[model samples]
Target: MSPQPQAAVGAPLSRVDGRLKVTGKALYAAEHDVKGALHAVIVDASVGRGRIASIDTRAALAQPGVLKVIHHGNAPKLPYRDNPASNNPPDGRRLRVFQDDQVLFHGQPVAVVVATTLEAAQHGASLVKVEYDERKPSTDLEKAKADKPTTYARGNAEAGLRNAPVRMDLTYRTARNHHNAMELHATIARWDGNKLTVWDKTQWVVGTQTELSTVFGVPMDSVRVISPFVGGGFGSGLRCWPHVVVAALVARELKRPVKLVLNRRQQYFGTGFRPAYEYRLRLGSDRRGRLAAMVQELDAETSSYEKFTENVMYAGQMMYSMPNVSQAYRTVPLDVNTPIYMRGPGFATASYVIESAMDELAAKLGIDPIELRRRNEPSEDESTNLPFSTRRLRECYTTGAREFGWNQRRAKPRSRREGDWLIGMGMAAGVYDTARMPAQAHVRLDADGTAVVDAAASDMGPGTYTSQTQVAADALGLTMRTVAFRLGDSLFPPTPPHGGSMTMASVGSAVLDGCNRVRQQAIKLAVEDRESPLYGAEARDVIVRGGRLHLNSEPARGETYQRLLTRNKRSHLEALGSFAGPAAKERHSFYAYNATFAEVAVDAALGLVRIRRVLGVYDAGRIISPKLADSQAIGGMVGGIGHALLEHTVTDHRDGRIVNANLADYLVPVNADVPDLKAIYLDGEDPNADPLGVKGLAELVMIGVAPAIANAVFNATGRRVRELPITAEALL
Candidate 1:
């Protein structure tokens, strides 16, 4: 039998929601209208570490339209129940709003003022004075004491390092980064009787709902969260923050809807950011560049209250073939909020350290950077001894090298110069785990030949709405316009949090399952009906296209879904699509791989650097939406540029104040910073990864970007600086 032709799955379709966004019809969290909703502004702590000494609310009460001022002194005690299912980290207690007078970090919410208008709330909040006994804060990562190390070991690293022919020890530092999504963290909470409804800007509505319910000592079902649109969320919205609690608590107390929005400065304190890191790496390799052993020491900043941790050491365990490997990852509790996942999370940080060291090793060995990686590539996951589902990193390197004109690059440093600008090319390998969580989607086929797919997922500027719609359209044999994908609602079918680049592999698979089931049901009915043209045909032999069921061999003989359903007296068909996840214990290692190449030009005398070109080739299983994938790849490259040369969150260690809290001071890549950027996705699918054959793409796009740019800098000049945001001083 001939295979069915694909028209939507691999097509380069534009975003389905682009028009709504450009036309200003899309509504965000703060845009939701609630009758008589009060405005709220929170008063932040003046000190990073301190105890509240006194509070004054007399002047705040005199503000026009000021209704109430909430603080630890006057606010009611919340349940603050311990919830194991909440998004809180595994260790330490979650922050309880208005439950204590101790300030653990700078920018902690000390009080809130509620008023009829935003201006009144701002004035009242300013008038609510707070006095605290300030204490010196441990905000600097280098000086802070680290907790007991979490260690991992395999073979004898000490012996391997002593016996190796070549050895290198290097240290790298990465600055703290924040997820500055265009939309502020805002929430509008309204209560009626025992139920609460909230319109919030979050990546995980279910997680927020659960946290809010537990905080208020209410049933989980009593709280409903609606967020039809989000400006952007990298990973900041993965967990519920204290401000969300404040909004709900204030709304419940006032018996009126309360709207709370964090301004640009408050966002730094309100949510999480990518913690600054200091990574020390030591490598022992043979004469041919095969790694003999490695030892890694990692330290990262975390909130003093919560011991937040990410998968920082996972890449060291399996990225290359090494018999002797040892690692110690320690979290340094400091006067700061807990760090959360940014674009690539821990892997991006690790890749910069490891891959940059790889380039250094290549320079010492006088071998091509790509050649050095090939010499150490492992056939299977060395850590787990499991075969890979799909390991196409070799293809990525070769294809990327060819397309990027790597052959023209000079192996020697400072060899290519045009006037005062020195041009050099560098490449690095990247990999991210193929993670899939259990997810479900509810699909409905209406009588009018249209379909609706619902899931409690989020877009977060990754094109989830458009990509899911394409998946459903292809599965249900309908046009893109005929299928509607609904997400970001608690009432929809439950899905995993919309980060980790797993939405496509997880939620997409669920949509496919549900839509396929509905199509199969229709096929069964038509084959069994006597009047149908598809009658007596085997179910497997029939295929659907454009809502018409036809024999695979005879495309002209078929009936529209509406005609067949009308004859059968059916209004709609519904089905639940679900993916239960990999088996309890997986037999294979699954991951997406990429090879990133960067060409950079540096001004030798003035210490100025500029990117000339960047190309990323990825082995990310399937391309559900080619156009969207391109956008994701380019965006990742832009973020990488920021991480390498622009973005930094400055802190005043004496008082634990964020020095650069606003966008102007905390730099990001503007349009002028990005140059010629390109991406190429290797065409293929992993059957073991997911039903959709996708291993994940969003995070993979950014995994090795920083290291690639850094290596290019080294090739341009003879300098090997190990710090992030390669500044002019470092180059000089």
Candidate 2:
């Protein structure tokens, strides 16, 4: 069939839901007005570990407006049937809310008070008393024992290292980080007899539905999750947290709607965080800066109950060409909550260590960093021995160096200075695997030349709503204003979780398929109809544009969809589209690549670092929306700045409690902290990646940011801190 006119797909369109959001019409999870809903406040455990000895709820129950106070002593035992489909850890049982007196971690929810108003719930929760058999907690990564290591070895790394002339061993540490999205993690649950519905802040409504069903031992269809709008979610909302279950359980037991919203302090322990990591690297390279061997040993923090892991070792194996490589990744189980993916996740942390090490190697060999990296560029992914589908990292480096004025940088550290400030420029390369999963979308084109597409996806502050609309608009041959895209309802077509940077490639492909099918149905109807214009024309020769079907060779001979559908007495045409992801045995390695450059000014006397500028050149495949892509890039750079210099979740290891839980103590990059920032995308497409040709930009943009800044700090100050949040004390 002839292709539809490509008008809206690449256009720089604003968010379709922008006006609704700015005008206060868009309802977030907590904003949904459920009638007669009670408020619930969770009471946290004071101790870090050990079982609860006694609980007293007399004061809470006596409080005015307090409907019920539920705790382990009085709460019913839930079925919590196995649900392998959800995002829970595969090897361990999930924490069941209010199931037992066991205290797994500091700030564990001991009880919840439900009342008519939020104020009453808060007051009642404060009045509740609890005593615990406290035990010393093990929260420090250095002090805790690690689980069995997940080992990988390709060649004789020790022998290769022994034969090489140049050898270096280094250790790097990254502090824990919180998601800290503007919207609090919240849920409002309502039950009608056996059926349950919840308005939640989540990245995957279907995942939440499945989890709720399994927890209550009910049919999946009986639980419906609705989340129309989300302020932000940097992977924290990917799974159903314990607080969501608490809300649902309260609603069901009390036979009334219940709402629970975690406050800022509770957010630190209530949800997941980016775990701290200690990575030690031993490398052997020739005098010419070509790597010969590498050995990587990493220890990361996780909860004692569930083991959490990320792609921390991929960079060591595939980022460069090495004949011998060995890796051992061990998780140090501590008295803390399980960790989740935050922004770039494991790749970001790995890039910092790998990129910083590359800079150090370049300094040792008197070689340019970019030239050294070029010399070690791999012809294929050595881990899988698969040719890359589209590896434009070289192009990204060239373009970024040219754009960021890399030639102006001085090779010597602390050589360029402006009075009390030291100036330096640095760059780092980044990569993220192109991830895709099976997804489905539903489409309906009405007789009025308008179309509506539905998918069980989410827009977690990345403009998913607008980008998907663009795909649908162009594929259906309709104007952007005429196409309506709806998501975040479990009743819609199933879609994969809205994280992993796969939403556009997976969900957008499904939407394109649905719209294309609907358009073809209209074309077939118009051509076969005896009373229509150009009735005998071949359907293959017809193309749609502006809601009108016409012969590709003779555009003037056409009929509007409105007239054709009105005459046929049809209300609308519908179709369901799907994407079956990649093949079982993938033949090619696919990944998005980027080169991030940073310029910084460090106060020589005060030891303060100020970012002068940042530039990111990405080789992520086809960009569906340029404006949205810029937004993602800028947000990522800001987040990276925080990761490098400001953000750190400080834990009081004595009690396993996060001391800097609130925004006042935990710092982030603000407008004043961020200077000039820019993003450039290479114009290309990878057919093997996905139907949309997008290799996923959100995560790639963030991967190299922290390392770039860290390298710049080293060049400016000639000091290697080897830890995140390069503080003034470390520099001084």
Candidate 3:
């Protein structure tokens, strides 16, 4: 088959759903209007860890519009079957909502009040009272006992450290962070006989469907999940939370639709968060900055019910060249909700520590930070001993340094000042492994010269709808307006989770294949039909442009798809395309690389740090949409600023309660906090990574942001605060 014209693939296009979003036409999970849907509010336990001793619901049940109060004593016992296919942790049992009196964490859902109106539900919930046998909670990461460690070793790390000329040991701490998206976590569930349907805020519809089916002990086909639009989900919606099941359970019990929207205060515990981490790194290097050995010990927070983990050790082994390396990762179970992936996840946390340590090492050796990193560049991935499919860190460094005026930076800290403020600039390199999974997409081309492509993919915020449309438009030889892309429906062709920076590589490739197949089917009909204009033309020499099939060499010798399909008396042509993911025996290690730079001004008297500018240069394969890519880059930088200087989920260890749960108390970067931000993409594609040649940009943009800012703070004030959220008190 001939290649389609490259018109829309790399074009800068606006989001297809932008107008709907701005006009409030895009319906989020809580906004869905289901007929006869009752409201439910969960009653939380006051103590962190304890068992419910007694409950009083007489006053709540007497309220007007109150329907029922369901607790462990009154709620029927659910099957609570094990579901390995979902995102639940594998180590321990999941929390069964309202199943027993045991309270595993503070704010555990002990009971729920159902009423015809949301206000009634809230009032009834507030009226109800519950007493608990309170117990002290193990909420402190430092004090809690850790589970067995997951260990990795490549060489004799301790011996290498002992023999190296220079050595350093550093410990860094990062606070927990909540997603805090604009829209709250919500679910609207309705049961029709044995079948269940839910409109949820989720990143993966099929995952939710499978989890709900398994939880209810029903067939997979008996559950349906629909999520057409999401306000934002920084990995919080990656799994089916307990509230989703609670909504479904209540709806089934009452034989009516149930709507549950977690209030802002409840959202803190209702959804997953980015776990707090304590990382200890030991490093040994030669005088010239060549790495010799490294050892890492990490402890992260997780719930007592289940153990959660992330890819925290990958960077320590492969980011730089090291002969000897060892790692031990442990999860400390606490009286908290399970943690999930957030933006960059493990890579973000690792990059902050590694990059900061590199800066410290450079300062110690009197060598330039960029030059020190160049000296440690690896020839291949030492972890797997495989050649890199595309490692462009050198190019990223050169590009970012030149673009951000790196040469003007002073090597001495606190040397450059502007009246009451000190200025500094810092840069860090980041890498994230490219991930792709099996996916399928369905495409249909009608006689009207239009195409529709769909998959069970989602767009939390990264413009998946527009980018997929671009892929389909070019492949099907249709205009952007003529190619319609739909998603977030379990009925569509299955796709992998929207996180992990894999949607474009996996789902877009499937859409491309499906569209290509449909376009080929149309061309075959035109070439073989005796009544067609290009009946004798070779199929290989034929090309499609704007719904017209023509010879590649002659533009005038073709007919529109409408003409060909109308003459053939065919309504439409459809195809299901799939990408089988990466090969079993991978030939190369694939990862996206970036160099992030930041400029900051610090006020010593006031102890305030202001971000002046941020620049990110990426070698993330081919960019499908430049405008949307910029949006992602800028948003990531803003988030990085928050992680470095402001965002922190403060918990009171006395009761395992989050004191700053509301947005009013929690600080995030607003319009005033964001500075001049820019993103530059290296021009090229990695054919080895995936069919689309995209190594995933969304997560890569966020990996090095926090580290860059943190390093800049040290350069400005000569103060190395090992902890995150570099507050004014720390500087003082």
TM-score of 1: 0.99
| TM-score on alpha carbons, each prediction | 0.99, 0.99, 0.99
The residue pairs that clash in candidate 3, if any, are none
lDDT by residue for model 1 (103-181), tens? 9999999999999999999999989889999899889999989999999999999899999999998999999999999
TM-score, candidate 2, is 0.99
The per-residue C-alpha lDDT of model 1 at residue 136 equals: 92
Residues 294-394 of candidate 2: C-alpha lDDT, one tens digit per residue: 99999999999989998888888899999999999999999998888899978999999999999899989999999999999999999999999999889
RMSD of each: 1.1, 0.9, 0.9
Q: Which runs in model 3 stand beyond 4 Å of their true positions?
A: none
Candidate 1's C-alpha runs over 4 A off are 1-4
| lDDT per residue as tens, model 3, 371-442 | 999999999999999999999999999999999999999999988999999998988989898999999999
